[model samples]
Target: MRKLFRRQGEQRKIRDKSDLIVKSNGQRNSELEKGINFYAEYLKHLDACSSGASQLSPSDEAHTQNSDLYDGKATFATTQSELLQKLEDAYQRESNLEEKLKEKIKSYQELKEENVSLNKQIESFTTGQTKLAEKHSRDKRALVEEIVELQRRLDGLTPSLALKEAQIARLETEKDTANNQVRNVTNQLQCLQMKLDEARRDEAVISKLDLERRDEMDSLRNSLKRFEIEIEDYKEKERTFAEDLSDLKRALREAELLGKKEKAIAEKALEENSGLIKENSELCAKISLLEIEIAQLNKDNEFRKMNDINLAELAEIRESEKRSKLEVSRLQEKLKAEQERLHNTEAQFDEYRKKEEEVGQWHHRTQKELEGLQTLSSSLSNENKLLRQDKLTLSDRCEELQNKLRKKDEEFERMRDEYETVSEHYRKVLEKLELETALQHERAGEYEDLVNRVHQLSASLSRDDSSSKSSRGKRQTASSENSSGKSTGEEKVQFIVLNLADLPVR
Candidate 1:
């Protein structure tokens, strides 16, 4: 019954130990899951922080997602620190983008103002053209009025000139008639002089009158008196002729003076006509020049319009160029950020892989520990079963010895006392063996506990490998401890065996 109770107690302890192991494994699994979740959350936060960046390409996004998967396995502290750095970088990029946008807007506004100024210039040109047209019309009206005034003056002068010409012709005819009359009068006077000479000669020849011709001489004297009277009349006619000739000469001089006056007036009129012709030529030249100026103005207006169109096109081209440059700059910044992120992710992945390798090694070591413990427990259980069998056989031997001693009590007292002493010595040896076996079990337990502690220390050392010197020191310490543990276990085994061998032969 005691054996059964003891075995039942041992089984209960084993069950309790297994349950404790299971609980511990569950807690460890839960902690690992929590750590993994925390890392994933940190990676997600980083993704959110970088999401607003405009420069991300499809390839970059893909790389980010892949990096997230890798980073999910990273420790919490590393993910948090890296996320903060990324957030700062993203903010800086955003600020740069905003500044570029503002510059573009300013350029656009300046272009608009320039276009407005060009329109105002075109309007001014149109106003100038209108003013030129008004001036040209005023000049044309003034020229027409002057031309009409000159025509009226020329019409007024024409009749006066014709009347002067007719007066000159009539004066010439009258002068010619007076000259012919003077010539006729001079011929008459010459004939009269010749007659007088003949009369004087006849008077000399008939100085004394004959008696027979007395009656004829008295009649001839009477005829001579009549001829003298006729002579007087002829002298008076000659004097009147001279006076008429002088009058004719004075009239010719007056006519010549009038002709000179008319000639002078005609010359004045010709000069005036020449001046008017020059004025007309000048006006015509001005008209032609004004037409050419108008044509030039029209051409200039067209050129200005073309220039405005060209300016607008140039402005558009400049704006497009600016936009393209801004986009390029933004893309370059995004590419830089992506490259930096990729670099950080690669480094994180490398660290994560190293940690994973260390974890795997740790799990392998733990499995080895569990296996070793299982073997030690099984060996202990087998030793206990053998000890129980030995105890049962020794009890049976004790019962037989007591029965024989009771039968021999009348015949061998001395032999009975000697048997008692031997039994007591055997009991002492069995007690010593039991105590040694217990000590061996306790040593085995201590060895297992030391192994577990060493494994834990090694795991901690692997985790802190960032400090190369410290990890090296820890590794050296762990090696020394492991050697010491092996040596102690071996010594304990040898001690147990020696104790077993030194037992008495009784």
Candidate 2:
């Protein structure tokens, strides 16, 4: 009866342990399901973040386009508008992503709470398992004591229980089956422990992934902030460029006005030059007339000398000659003044050429600026074309100016050659006048010596007359010879004066 009670108690204990193991398995399965569901939620969040990141990649591409725009490569207002739209869309998407992230974060928090609860539950389960193991050990010790007591009873009552040996063998088989069930329950508990460890490892992996995702999100936010700042800088640069364009336009207008003024000034200068040319032609005519008059005066002077003109008349003629020389000198001074005026004009032309060169340089600079502006904005293409046309016109004007300058230089060279010829002519005239003056001085000395010789011959003739008749004949012959010599000398002097007067007036 005691053995039967012990067998029943052992069977009950096995059944209870199996029930506890089954309940632990059911709890473990429920916890595993919760963990799996949490993992699924985490995976879903990860997928959402990945999708958001994928969407952000396009935004980054758009940002690159924005960078290109900043580099002055966009279709102006249209591109700006499109970029604004894209930015707004990106903002919306980011907002949506932020909301999703917030939701995901909240869910992650919930999952963490659930994980904490699950961990607490797992710990309680482990404690329950430990308690159950301790209880099982105490029960096993009691069972061992009971078995010892039963063995002692069996030894004591072996002869009497000989007829119940088959029943005892059957009880032994039941105990062996209970032992197998207990071993299976222990193996199931160990499997549950392993499953719990695996769940913990999975949770650790999920937390690590969450941290990485948070880091990525932070980086994305930083990048977005940088993009916003860059966009602002682009806006400021655009404003500055617009201001520069306006300034360029104003400068171009000013240049046009200055060009008009320069044209007027050039026209005035041309008129003045024409007048000066007319004056120079008149002066050349006057100089030619003066040279003709000088030649005439020289011929008249020679004629008067041949007619035995008085010294006072000669003095008056010399005074007239001096007046002519003074006039020639005045003409030369006027020519010099004209040359100085030409030099001043040349200096002015040089200044004008420098100004034109400066204008061309300014034009080149403006063209460069315009080209840069054109690159910055496609909307300015038409303006650039117009500017190019203006440049073409300006270039044509520059070519015309250069041609005019060449002509002016040629004219200046001709004028200089003419002036040089006139100066050489004047120098030749002055040399002739100097030679004529030296000849006149030598003729005067010869005339004075002939007059003194005439006086001496007349006095000698008078003395011969007062002395003897025979001597008077010799004196007359001598006087005749001297008179003949004097006549020859006077003819020679007249010939020389005529030759001098007849010299070509170059």
* Candidate number of the best TM-score: 2
Model 2, position 199, has a per-residue lDDT of: 48
Off by over 4 Å in 2: 1-198, 310-315, 378-506
> What does candidate 1's lDDT look like per residue over 1-506, in tens digits?
35444545555654565466556555655755675687677768776845733357878767765676566546445756765565465456546545654655565456556556656766787899899999977965565454334334434543553453354345335434543544544454344344434433433333222222444444444544554454455445545554654555565566556556655655665565566556546655654665575566447546767776466655665575566556556655655665565566556556555655665565566556556655655665565566556556655655665565454443344444544555565565556556655654564454445344434433333333233333346467654644354334334434433432342211
Model 1: ten consecutive residues of lowest lDDT: 203-212
Cα shift from native, residue 408, model 1 (Å): 6.7
What's the lDDT for candidate 1?
A: 0.52
What shift in Å separates residue 352 of candidate 1 from its native position after superposition? 2.3
- Top lDDT prediction, candidate number: 2
Q: Write the per-residue lDDT of candidate 2 for residues 1-506, one digit (tens) a residue.
A: 35444545555654565466557555655755565575577557555655555556688857754664454433345545765665576566557655655665666566556556666777898899999999987976565455435434434443443333344345446545644654665565465556546545655654565565556556655655665565566657767888898899899889878877876776777677677767777777888888888888788889888998888988998898899889888987887787677677767767776887788789789989988976876544444455556556655655665565566556556655655665565565556556655654565454445445434433433333344243336566655644454344334434433433342222
TM-score of each: 0.19, 0.37
